[model samples]
Target chain A: MILHSIGWDDILQATLATLAMLGGSLFFTVLLGLPLGILLFLTGRTQLLDQTFAYGLLSVVLNTIRSVPFIILLILLMPVTVLLTGTSLGVRGVIPPLVIGTAPFFARLVETALREVDRGVIEATQAMGGSVSQIVFRALLPEALPGLIASVTVTAVVLVDYTAMSGAIGGGGLGDLAIRYGYQRFKTDVMIVTVVLLILLVQILQAFGNRLVIHFTRK
Target chain B: MNSQPSQPIVSLRGVSKDFLVGGRAATALRDINLDIQRGEIFSIIGSSGAGKSTLVRLINLLERPTAGEIAFKGKPITLVKGEELRTIRRSIGMVFQHFNLLSAKTVAENVAFPLKLSGVRSSSVIAERVSKLLARVGLQDHVAKYPKQLSGGQKQRVGIARALALQPDVLLCDEATSALDPQTTRSVLKLLAEINRDLGITIVLITHEMDVVRQISHRVAVLDHGQIVEHGRVEDVFLHPSHSKTRELVHEAEPENDELNLGSIPRGQIYRLTFVGKRAHTPILGTVAREFGIDYVITGGRVGTIRDVPYAQLTISFTDGNVHGAIARLRASGVSAEHLNGANSEAPLKATAT
Candidate 1:
């Protein structure tokens, strides 16, 4: 009551801003993550496309980045955030950091997805005289599609959580409003509403992700 | 020097493979040399880990030998690489222990994969080729189904069609029927034999079963510890295995003394009977038993064929024992006989293998 009741316009703008940050970050991540995942999968030990040094180094680097906590990554990537998007303060600034955080995670997920495909299939392709490229496109990618979708769904959920968290640091989303109106002004209602909104977003994301994965898998 | 200038379809010389384990090298093959004539079913048989798979893989360049040379069609393919190597591989089809068909692809796509690799243009052409291959294999209705939806034998038919897609000059099979049951294995092998006969595609296969080797292979090689110990025509090998190591064991105990003991030929004046070529099916055993004027007890007898010519071996004992002249009379019948046991002895005489 102290900071006044929530305005209808604020909720709409906040949701839109959250969507922009999460959607834009996910797009960039998938773009970079898919190829990176393929590289990791193909180059690993015992893989059809084996490369000892390359696979080893990439795996180490991915694990290293993933080990860092998201909050710390956001702070640490401040300069990169500014350089990429011209500001380290708003939703645009938060995107680069969000992508860096999530891309490695998604890439690892995708690598697992690609690896889960039957090795017999790859050999069959080779016995058929398939080149490395053909095997990747026709055999590996198509076979891993369902698992890839599931990974994407999981990644989207993680991004949604990051989006909410980004609001706490002034990225202009529902979280930012809750921080500005609820925590600062001690208004329990603002905090409660933002919490409800996040929970609702999570439910929608999980449901949609499940639907997409099911569609791709035809199950 | 006057031999025909016909090209050998598959040749291996001093081919050896060594794998490092625990900082020591283990040789999988040693100084193996062979020449397989074109359009023949050549089989390599040995106990497991006999380097048969390794040797077959070398033909398609799936594995580079640790030492020595492999040539296909009179060309040394040792240095072939990149696109050239791929093109060479395209002309050779290979099947594996597990059928190795892509579970995700339908039968048509799996069969068409090699053609696509050969850079076949136009889906229509690919489709026509697939239909023709499937029809040949008797799987015309299963073309649209995935490998998981098919039986083991059907999956192998798809594998065969894929291998034959480019109409490759040579086909390699590495235990292709090992994963299948006996009946399915026979049918798949028969299908391979037909492909060899009808299309004249040379086949190189590896197996552990002597029966399989006898069924269709023209030439057979026996490998032990990465070395070719015995190699000859299937008929010769089956009739008289030259090596003590050639005796197949019921189980792996020791390779040194594993005699096949084709059942003990009867003891007590036992005569080792030898029948070759036409003598196999002529009821010679009954005739000899009655005519020899000696009581005969058959302890060992078998009906088999060498070179599609039926034959039998019998170890029979003569009652009242054998007079020296009775042996002379049997020898007069154009039969090779040897005393198995000492005069009325418990063990049959060992005949010298022909």
Candidate 2:
């Protein structure tokens, strides 16, 4: 039976690899995207730190990165991924491309979330003699917190799919495990199990994101 | 109404504001010279686009004058920047028509926000100040709730509490009560009047509603097309509007009359008499009728106290005879009369000088 060929150790290793790539990439994605998003927001038209030149440059860069399809981005970034992670066929190798692929996507979402903050609220903060930094941290971020959480949830979910695609390029994870064992070996049970697991992971991530959003949302 | 002749808190000298709308220079305020006295409730009243909002914003330097000087406490605010400008702004708290309370914050947090921004670090101090201001505005019970949980009136109360958090010297209200219902507006105005009376905080509120000025302001400025057309004591402006714009606003504040009843009498001169001060309470009409042997019928009138000064306006038609002598006698008693016969025409009789 196909079950005899796929043991608990194989399933465990794939799950661990998938978790490592997803978790590591998500951390770097957030770390890089959050500030990039804030910079995008601040330099936006009519914003507190509005600079047309800076905003235009950032907008072009972000748009250029976002226009590329994720699979091509993963393949295109392979050389740079190998240079950064010292290998191009494992969990570490997968992380750089996954993060690079999703960071701009997450950043654009972040900019949109920040823009969703009411201008009146920002003006009120300014009228209170709040410094620019104080207004950003104290008023804008808190007001946009729920939307940001939702953005992160969406980014994480997209990252899950991106990680799977990276698996096609020998980026080891459940996707690599499924393709190597399920598709190539024609193991139908392994494919069904991996698909079900991916779906469950997405459901969990979405539910947790929704709960966090609800917890923070005041209005 | 604060009538004490104290030093002016804010003074504008030939202040002008122009906006380039779609590449065309549009003036929002033009050569505005005005003084807002310490402890007085100064109101700027105008129709929309008359630059009343721009005028009030200029006082706090929120909207800089295109050309001219604005001084607060005799210090030029136009030249200040960074910390110095922030210090000045902290002393002048502003309330918005939309209330602009932070929706993510609780009532207590919203009220404490300015204090926090001013770098008040002590939690206990912030808590005490927030509670005191909330209590003053009568929102003591909703401290833990968010702004979305409150009514429009309650949200404005939070705004007022937040504005008062720093114990600011001047409160700038940019159509603060315009968003609320009539009953809510009255309560908020009453709260503002109390704040002025109890704390001696000079309030500069701009509104398109003349009744807002009529209810609580000590002095009023009427703005039209980016210029101050008229300004005087609220009582004076309410009773005798010099500009057509002001007259239109005053009429809008009052209920409309369907028809002018001449009391089923024959053709006679209809006189609109203005009674002020003691004469507003006196039986001047009776005295005139008896003294000059003139029969008259009261047609329509509105008598009320403005800025604590008694005032009355009455439309009376003479019966059986000419009452020009009665008008002279009414003028003798310090009551001014305007012949209402030509009121609909542009040349309505001017109020007789006392």
Candidate 3:
């Protein structure tokens, strides 16, 4: 437990690292995964942008990445991470791998959520002479907002896991701190702090997501 | 009834629709030739799978036909596309059985949809049109409510308002009130009749209910197996249903005719005496009874009007007599009469027969 009292500066640094990784990875994941998810959904056989080719491609890529473990995904994207961030270690280097590791998984969840939107609503919008883009932006997106929120929550929670795991690849975060101080040095207090932070984040994301979903869906 | 001949507003010739089904083709309509006149309420009715819905949708061009021509007011529009199709569609409004109101939109917004689609910029104009249309449909107060908040009839009223938002020349109803309860259906039907009468918008409706057809339609087309089996003015169709499908669909018994007081008359010798035209007012039964010294057993009948022309049917029986002189006297006076009862069918008056 000495690592717990090992200086407020070190603990603060680890906490900042975790926050940076989590926030940065979340922004990147949403930016990348959202469009990927929309593509997967819209390109599906029955969707607004329906096309067999795009759906098949998205299906293959998502399944391929998902089949490989997150650790392997991070390792596979190591070179791309270095080229983008100009580093292969510490918090600065972690964002690219973290996004690559989480985006496909997040995208798949989003696709499922978008698919849950009613086709009837889409048809009604079309009957009203709404163009393809208008129907997408107004009808499909609005109708599927609640489910999308729930999927975003799930993605955010999964992102927390990805952020934590990113620490192992020579990256600085709560996970890295825990591994460096808590595991390697047997610092029980450090482990407890990291674990507690994760629980709190999960709680906040879950609560917010559930509330947003209810807010949109309730008549 | 106005005797003026209205212009034909919607005309389709040799229009056929076919769908691809698992490497095969299925025909929904085959060379459907029809003309719907202005200011007339037309009804197309048939059993399920008769392609009535498909036929109705053709006017708005929801589904383009695989072959042939559709002309609306002399302009051939079977090949309309993109902006042209939208412009064409704006002049023709359609309602559905499900009352397809956007669940997310308020009644006002739903009514404003067609206007919005037509690129109407002024809210004042849209609001004025919506209010006028809603007032016509008797749904003026329901403008703020969403579809889920309203009953089926109220939802349909909103639908009618929405369809009229563009002030289309033709209104197509695809089984509009088929989803409503009987009472609600009646009220909605009455409202549609009022719309047709007030706005003078030509309406072409599709329904499975003959009562709905009878309620508002000036003329009806009976569809079966993707073909029009019968078509004519509703009164003519009712009076003489020529086609087998028409006979099946025209309905033999009507609720208005149920006021017949059928139980009062003895069943010994019953006859259905029908008088066509002005004779419905004349007391011819009394003349037959007095002229032949015979008591006439009046059974079932009521004062009724058909196609704005009054007509009456009376179920009567020969109360007591050889009934020969009464039959002769009734037939001679331009009053059509018959010997009563199916049970005593073999008996006939010698004077009438010879």
DockQ of all candidate complexes: 0.45, 0.76, 0.31
- For candidate 2, the lDDT comes to 0.86
Q: Candidate 1, residues B1-354: lDDT per residue as tens digits?
A: 014357788888888888787779989889889898988889998889878888887888777888989998889897788787888888888887877776556789888877776788899999999999999889999978888788889888888998899989988888888888999988998899889989999999888877678778888888888899887777656655666556562112222221224255333565666777766656655665566556766665556654356666666666653445667766676566766565644443234422
Worst 10 residues of 2 chain B by lDDT: B345-354
Instruction: Mark the regions of model 1 whose C-alpha exceeds 4 Å error after superposition.
Output: A1-4, A186-193, A207-219, B1-5, B249-278, B288-295, B304-311, B318-354
Instruction: In model 3, state the lDDT of residue A106.
Output: 81
Q: What DockQ was computed for model 3?
A: 0.31
Question: Residue A160 error for model 2, in Å?
Answer: 0.5
Considering TM-score, where higher is better, how would the candidates rank from best to worst?
A: 2, 1, 3
Worst 10 residues of 3 chain A by lDDT: A119-128
Residue A199 lDDT, candidate 2, scale 0-100: 89
TM-score of each model, in listed order: 0.87, 0.93, 0.81
True contacts kept of each: 0.40, 0.72, 0.16
Cα lDDT of model 3 by residue, B66-135, tens digit: 9889989889988877677777777787788887676767888888876776678799998898888888
Among the numbered candidates, top DockQ falls to 2
Per-residue CA lDDT of model 2 for A98-203, tens digit only, reads: 8888999899999999999988888888777887888889999999999999999999999888887788898877898788888999988888788788888889
